[model samples]
Target: MFCYQCEQTDRSDNLLLGCHSVKGNCGKDDRTATLQDVLIVICEAIGQYAVLLREKGVVDPTWAHRASYWVFTTLTNVNFNATVFQRMIADAIVLRDELKARYEAACTEAGETPVVPEGAAQFVPDPGMAGLLKQAPLVRVDANIDVLGADVVGVRNLNLYGLKGLCAYAHHAHALGHRTDETDAGIEKALAFLGDPPTDLDSLLGHALELGSLNLKVMEMLDAANTGVYGTPVPTQVRVTPVEGKAILVSGHDLGDLAAILEATKDTGITVWTHGEMLPAHGYPGLNKYEHLAGNYGSAWQNQHAEFAAFPGPIVMTSNCLIEPQPSYRSRIFTMGPVGWPGVRHLEHKDLGLLVKAAQALPGFATTDPERSITVGFGHDSVLANADAIVEAVKAGDISRFLVIGGCDGAKPGRNYYTEIAEKSGDDTILLTMGCNKFRINGHDYGTVAGLPRLLDIGQCNDSFTAVKIALALADAFDCGVNDLPLSMFVSWFEQKAAAVLLTLLALDIKNIRLGPTLPAFLTPAVVDVLVDKFALKPLGDPTEDLANAMAGA
Candidate 1:
C-alpha cells in the first residue's frame, strides 16, 4: 500500500514489502492504511466530478452531499465501524462510476476526451495491487504536540479536521435544500489544495487561513437557509426544567431533525427538550410555538458524560459533539443523520418510531421548576434591527466594546479561560457567542446595555454567520471597515467547522482574532507564520491580558 496523507510516512518508501514491523510500530495495520488511500482517491474522483457538473451548470446535490459526508466520516473517531466504512466505499464507487459515465457521455456529445480538472487524480493509486489490497488505506496516526508549537504535521491535521467540520455543515445545509455555489466551490478548491504537496511552511499556513475564510461563507449560507426556513430568531427565554413525564432530548445542530422530532412527538404526551447547541431552537418562533417544546438541558457537550447519564428520557443527536455515553444513558442516546456512537440507537432517516416507543416505555421527563431562565435568539436579523441602537450605545460610551466569543468546548480544563474572560469583561462590553462553546459562560448575568442583553447566544456554530453579519452591520453603521469597529473575535475551535469559519474570516482579512484552547495538529511552522503575519492571527493568551488588549483600543 502506498499513502502519504500524514507526515509520519516516509515519502521515499513506496513499497510496503518487509515494512510490516515498521507499520506495526506506527500502530496502523497495512490493510487499514491501504483502505484510507483508496478512500482518498475516491474522494478525489468525486471532487473532479463535482467540478465537471459545476462547469456544465448542472450541479448534482447528491454528489455534493456524498462528497461532504465522506470527508466528514473519514475524520478521526467519526467512523470506526468497518461495516459502515465498507458501505460508504461501495456507495462511493457507484457514484464515481455514474459520474464518470455522465462525463464521458457529455464529452462524446461535444466530441472530445473528458478534460478532468487539474489535481483531481492525485489521490487515485496506480492499479496493480493484489485482490486482498483493494480496500482504501487507513490514515496514519501522529503523536500529540504542544498547542502552540509550529509543527507542520500538527497544522495540517488541524486544517484537515477544520475542513471536515466545514464540510459537514455544508452537507447539512445542502440536505435541507439550501445550496451555495461559492461555498461548494470553496470546499472543492480547499480539498484539492490539501492533496497538493506542501511547498513550504508559508504556503501551508496560507492554506490553513484560507480554510477559515471559506468556512465563513459556508456558515453564512447555513445561517441564511435556517433563518429563511425557520424565521429570524428572537430573544426568547428558555426554561431548564424537564417536563415530568415522557420526553425527548434533541441535541446537535440539525434543525431539520429537531422539527421532525417536534412533529413526531406532538400530541403523543411526550415533550421535547433542547440540549447542547440545540438550546437556541427555543428562540425560533416556529419551534417555540410547540407548548411541549421545553427548555435546555446541560450546559454544553463536554458535560454530556455526566449530564446524559442522568437524562431519564430518550435523546437524539442530529449532528456532532457526541461524547461517549455512560451505561445508564447509553440506551437512551439515539443518533440520527451523521452522528454515530457505538452501542447507541441510531435513528435512520426521519423515523422516530424507536424514540417514540422508547419514550413511551420510559418514565418520561420531569416537570420541576426550571434551573434558571436565559434569553437566546439574537441572530443576525435581531442584531441588525438593533444596529442603530448598538452603534449609538458604543458612540455614547455605554457599550465600549463588542466581543465575538464562540466555538467548541472540550474536556480540557484550561477552557475555563473562556469563563474567566466572560466574567471579567467590563460592564460596557457586549458578548456575542455561538456554538456549544458559549455555554461555558452563558449563565453569567453580564447585565444589559441600551435594552440589549450583555450576553447574546447566536444559535449554533453555523450561526457564526450571524455573528459575522452583526460585525459587518456594525461596521456599516459605524461607516468604517469591520476591523475598524470596536470589536474583537476571541474564538475557540475544536473541530473542522471551526476551521472553515476561521478560513472565512481570514479570507475577509479579519485580523487579530484570538484562537484557542489548542491549535490544530496539522499545521506546519511556515503555515503558522503566514497566518500571524498576513492576518494578525494569534493564539489565546491569559484572559486578563487578552481582555485588556481587546478593550484597550476600543
Candidate 2:
C-alpha cells in the first residue's frame, strides 16, 4: 500500500512521504490503494478532456461533478472496495474517450490538431486486478516524487487533498439540490489543474493557495445549501440518551438521506437516532420537526466500531467515514449514496424500507435512559445574531477569549489533547467547536459564560465556514483584522476535509493555529517550514502548555 492522504499515514523515523507496507495504517490493503491511485489518474485524464470541452464552449456539468465524485471517493478511508473503484475506472475511460472524440472533432473543424497528454489521456486501464496492480506504480502518489522533489510533491498533494475535501462538501450540498454554475466551473478548473500540475515549487505553492480560496467559496456555498434548504440552525438541545422504542441510528453527513429516512419512517413508531457527524442534524428546524428524530447515539466516527455493535437496531451510514463492519453488526449495517462495502446493502432510490423493517424486527432499547442532553445549532446565524452580546461580554471582561477547538477526529492516541484543551480551558474562555472533534469534550459539562454555552456545537465539519464568519464578525466589530482578535484556534485533523479547512484559514491569513494530532505525512519538512514561517502554524505539544500559551497570548 502506498497511501498518505490522511494525517495518520504510517510515518516512522526514516520515512514520511507514504505508507509502503502491505496494509496502510488505516486498514486499507495494497489492492485498494493501487486501485485508488489508478482511479485518480483516470479522473485526472477525464478532467483534461472536460477542460478542452469547456474551452470549446460546451458546458457539461456532469463531467465536473463526476470528476469531483471520483476524487472524493478516493479520499482517505472513504472507499475500500476494489470493485467500486474498478467500475469507476471503467466509467471514467468511457467518458474520457467520448470527450476526446468531441475535442478532436471540434479542433479539426477549427482546422487545428488536438493536443492530448500522454499519461492517463492515452493509457488504457486493465480490466483485471493483476493488470491494474501492474499499472499501479505508474500512478501512485510517490510515482514522480523522485523527479518533482519533496517540496513540489508536498504542494501538489496539498492542492489535491484540499480539492478532494472541497468536492466532498460540494457533493453533499449538491445532493440537497443546492449547487451553482460558479461552483461547478471552479471544480472543473481545479481538476484540470490536477491533470497538468505545476512542477515548480513556487507555482505549486501559489496553486495551493488558490485551492484554498476555491475551497472557501465551496464552503460558503455549502453553508447556504444547508441553511437555505433547511432553516438556519438555531440553538436546539439534543438528547444523548435513547428513547424506548425500535430505533434506526443514522451516521455520516448526508442530511438528504437522513431527511428521507425520517419522512419514510414518520409515525411508524420506530425512532431515528443520529450517530457520528449526524448529531448536528437536530439543529435544523426542517429536520427537527420530526418527533421521532431522536437524539445522537455515538461519539466520533472512529468509535463507530464499538458503538454500532452495541446498538440494538439497524445502523445506516449515509455518506463517508464508514469502517469495515464488525461481524456483530455487519448483517444490520447498510450503506447509502456513494459509500459502499463489499457485502453491505447499498440503498438506492432514496428508500429506507429495509432499514425500517430491520428496526421493526429488532428489539430496541426496552426503556428510556437518563434525561441527558447537549446544546447544538449555534451556527453562524445564531452566533452572529447575538453579536452585540458577545462584543459586550468581551468588553466587560466576562468572556476573556474565544477558542475555536474542533475539526476531523480520528482514532489516534494523542487525540485526547482536544478533550483536555476543552476541559482545561478557563472559565472566561469560550470554546467554539464544529466537526466530529467536538465529540471528545462535548459529553462533559463546560458550563456557561455570560448566558452562552462555552462549548458551542456549530453543525458539521462543513460548518467551519460558520466559525469563520463568527471570527470575521468579531474582528469587524472589534475594528481589527481576524488574526488580531482575542481568538485562538486549535484544530484536530484526521482527513482531507480538515486539510481543506486549514488551507482556508491560512488563505484568510488566520495565524497561530495549533493543528494536531499530527501533520499530514504528504507534507515534507521543507513544506512544514514554509507553513510555520508564513502562517505561524504550530504542531501541538502538551495540551495544558498549549492552552496556557494561548491564554497568555490572549
RMSD (Å) of each candidate, 1 decimal: 5.5, 1.5
The 0-to-1 C-alpha lDDT of every candidate, in the order given, reads: 0.72, 0.86
Clashes of 1: 46
TM-score per candidate: 0.86, 0.97
Give lDDT tens digits, candidate 1, residues 1-554.
Answer: 33222223342333331123325222344554455445655766677666665666656666766778777665432443444555666777778778778877887887888875544353444344444264222223232223324355556555666677788888778767887767777776666565542635557667776777778777777777787778779989998766678878888878888988888889998888898889888878888889888788887876877787778888887787666577878878888776665566778655677788998988875556646788899888888888788888888999988888888877665788888889999888999988888888887788887888899998888787778788888788888998898989888876667777777788778889898875553444466676788888888788999899888752
Tell me the RMSD of model 1 versus the true structure: 5.5
Give the top-scoring candidate (TM-score): 2
Number of backbone collisions per candidate: 46, 0
Compared to the true structure, candidate 1 yields what TM-score?
A: 0.86
